[model samples]
Target: MKNLFPILLMLIIMVNASAHGGKNHEHANIFENLQGNNKAAILMVHFGTTHDDTRALTIDALNKKAQAEFPGVELREAYTARIVIKRLGERGIIKQKPQDVLAQLKKEGYTHILIQPSIIIDGVEMESLQKDVVEVQSQFKEIRIGDPLLYSPEDYEKLIDVLTKNIDSETAYIWVGHGTYDSNTAQYAMLDYMLKARGHTNCFVGTIEGYPSFDDMHQQLKASRLKKVVLVPLMFVAGEHAKNDIAEDWKNDLEKEGYSVEVKMEGLGQNPEVQDLYISHLKFKSAHRKIGIIEKKAIYEVTGEKME
Candidate 1:
């Protein structure tokens, strides 16, 4: 028994170390390696929404929250979607692109930049954002990009908690996300599995264009024997996709199949907890001041070439 004490202690220490290493690695000093007179600013990038109502509730609300939390830290926003920007332009509302924003920031003499995207997952949009940042990376002293909402395992658990806080266990719940053709679409499936694993068996996830399609979720709903369903938008804003795809189309299809449907009409960004998660991600990146780039795995998958 005496000989086993040290071995048991060692095993416990190793387990604790592994867990801390994976999740809390960003706890290091954010200003440790930073140098010079740092004129720091934050750039919040969104996919750009055309609807003013949902934009105020989601995107504008989030931006206000960020500005409040970061008090006196100059903050700006950029839209990734050109079509949205163009449409808004026709209305005489100007929205800048990411590259243009970065250029303007540089011209204003900002030395450091921390970019946080309001994206649900690391899909093609994230890849494109990284490429844009990389192009003008030389303009700034240091630039760091934060991870998306569902980047790490901890992120998945956090999101599950946020989404399922007021969940109705008796009625089936389906989260509809704008799924991508890229491999990142797997995140949606993983979210569905994690929801079930965490005891929310009634919860389901499906993408508009990716795997775990509407049919897949419909089949699951049939097997579960639940007649009532709640459709929630997994996207940041309850814009065209949520209003049209989930609210109108999905609801119609499910009702036709003899199931009672209730549309939430709320985007993920509307949730205070969800907004805080994005802020936390920005704080993490701000402290580290590391270069923001696409993950090596994503780069290889997209271009078929490994990043060193």
Candidate 2:
């Protein structure tokens, strides 16, 4: 009976260990099953540009960086600008829209999708992208859109650090963006405010078609009394606006105001730090299925309670 007692105790211990370990093993198996079923891909959406030089420097470089950051995951690009896609098609360069690319992804049996847009602000383009994704949301198992470059306050602060790395006290810097007429244009003004608040007093921000107009920026420049001014494009690509509007129009106007102006023909995408920022956002979204309510609240606060 004594020997039987020892054997029975050993059997109980073995049974307990198996029970506990088997439960954990079963959970691990479930997690692996879910991961295995998810066939994921990233869709990089850019406003796109016809200028090959800027395209190569900005869009192409960003795409290559993203691919390197997430190896073995298929990556594709789409252009949000209909006109840019059409123009590229005319030249034997075919660029698809977000919806078209989404369809292709679905056809390829991709169940999960992460869409990252190379957009400066969450404005009209972002709204349009959201709608396009909504139309085909049922086609995919899951889809998440990463935030724009300047969505959160942290994003703005990080961008400022990237942009003001080479600030010169003697020169005034102006960041020109393609602003929209909607209230979203206020983001540019917010960036301008943040710049000065962070001791970038020599820097100013202006838009082509929105608030803080060229005159507004020029007035600030005149007040600053800085003789030299540098124009930087606050855009994904230094395309037509940076080349012509800023290089010619803003530069000439500043020159007329007795300020020696120089335009930096570089886009936001060309900055390595900016590319990494986008990748970080993608990584974050990949880990978290949806953005937090705090982020949504921030967007609403910036857009005057407008969710879209």
Q: Listing every candidate in turn, what is its Cα RMSD in Å to the true structure after a full C-alpha superposition?
A: 8.5, 11.1
Q: Which clashing pairs does model 1 show? A: 30-287
| Best-matching candidate per lDDT | 1
Q: Local distance difference test, per candidate?
A: 0.85, 0.84
- Model 2 reaches what TM-score against the true structure? 0.84
Candidate 1 at residue 287, lDDT?
59
For residue 14, give model 2's deviation from the true position in Å: 36
lDDT of 1 by residue, 266-302 (tens): 9999999999999998877765433114443443454
Instruction: For candidate 2, list the clashing residue pairs, or say none.
Output: none
Q: Per-residue lDDT for 61-86 in model 2, tens only?
A: 98899899788889999999899999
Estimated TM-score per prediction? 0.85, 0.84
Task: Output the lDDT of residue 146, model 1.
Answer: 85
Off by over 4 Å in 1: 1-37, 289-308
